[model samples]
Target: MSELVEIREDAPGGPAARALFDEYIELVRERLSLPADFEPPEHIFASADVFTGDGAAWLVIFDAAGEPIGCGGLRVLEPALGEIKRMFVSARARRGGHGRRLLRELERRAAAAGMERVRLLTTVVLHEACVLYATEGYREIDRIQPPAGPPEIWLEKPLYS
Candidate 1:
């Protein structure tokens, strides 16, 4: 049966939100092939401060059973600009359009808050995510080669036409 999913705006540190964040961390570690003992940095973990600034928002999507299926956060990076972060869909709940829905809601929230554009960071290792961003109208704006790990790509989308 197709699951009924609902996206809710909530703080990153909330119970359900935290669970999704934990899952996302593990998935990222695996996708990036990091050591098992690696602990996520403060910015990558459940840091409420990151989503508390101007035009910022956090959203969690849950299935009909009330289990978190996906999550993402938007934070203002500068005037008229916002950044999307921590986007994830649980491995069990993917391919159900949850990621697209979560991303649309985040962009809607940003636009409603007067943001002119939104940007996100991703690496090639997250193939599905990069594809999703591309299909959602995001375009590669910049790329950076870190001292270690895969190169990072920054994508941007204008909130309005």
Candidate 2:
């Protein structure tokens, strides 16, 4: 049977949030073939304060059995700019529209927070994510070589007309 999925907003760094973040990090590391010692930057694994503060939000998706399946977060970058961080859907949940749902919710929350634009960074290894962002109206900005992780493709979307 198909499971009912629910998305709920919550403070970051909680048990469920941390579990999802860890899963996301591990998946990225493995998918990008990063070394075992590699660690994601602090900004990507946001602290509770960041999500609870002004112009920020965290969302976690749970299945009908109350198992966490996916999560994403939005953080204010500037007065009218926000960033999408740590978006992930478990392997078991792939191809089921949960990622798209989480992304749309993040955009809606960002717009509700008065952000006119949103940006995100994903690696070349994450081709599915690149396609999703592009299909959702986010345009490629540039390529960035971050100090800690794999090379990334930067993307931005205008939230308002």
Candidate 3:
């Protein structure tokens, strides 16, 4: 089996990335059975904004064939706190260590940016993500029922000081 992986950081959010983002959004919407009128706002792409503005960094995993198989990113929420964002791996890519690779890259970038800690907000529906975070040294900070909809789980991990 040839090595089937690569990580990229300069990926931009043009038509291709936007299309992928939409596909991801559609999958989430279908899984959650969200209302038809519940389209996410443009600001939801703030993760991309942060990436472009240098306030965040994105890591994308590509298979040997040069197809994007997984992605994750980190946004600096405050001077010393980074927010992990948009972690996803295609179903076919699960259990292949892609997610973990993306996560480690995010952490490295956060540490390089001088962040002392990293955090992320996920929902109960994302059980796998919660498991990954917990396994990777993240601890629960709080749980909240936001005006948005579902119960939100917040987790944090300390980065290199």
Q: Which stretches of candidate 3 lie over 4 Å from their true place?
A: 1-3, 41-47, 53-55, 147-149
Clashes of each: 0, 0, 0
Q: Arrange candidates by lDDT, highest first: which order? A: 1, 2, 3
lDDT of 2 by residue, 9-40 (tens): 86577788888777777887788787777777
Candidate 1 residue pairs in clash (backbone atoms < 3 Å): none
Write candidate 3's Cα lDDT for 20-134 as tens digits: 5666677678767887656665433454767654558877777888777777778888889988877787666778777887898889888988889998878777777878888
TM-score of each: 0.91, 0.89, 0.85
Error in Å for residue 11 of model 2? 3.1
Once fitted onto the true fold, the runs of candidate 2 whose alpha carbons sit more than 4 angstroms away are 146-150
Pairs in steric clash, model 2: none
Q: Rate the local accuracy (lDDT) of all candidates.
A: 0.85, 0.83, 0.76
Q: TM-score order of candidates, best first?
A: 1, 2, 3
Cα-based RMSD of candidate 3? 2.6
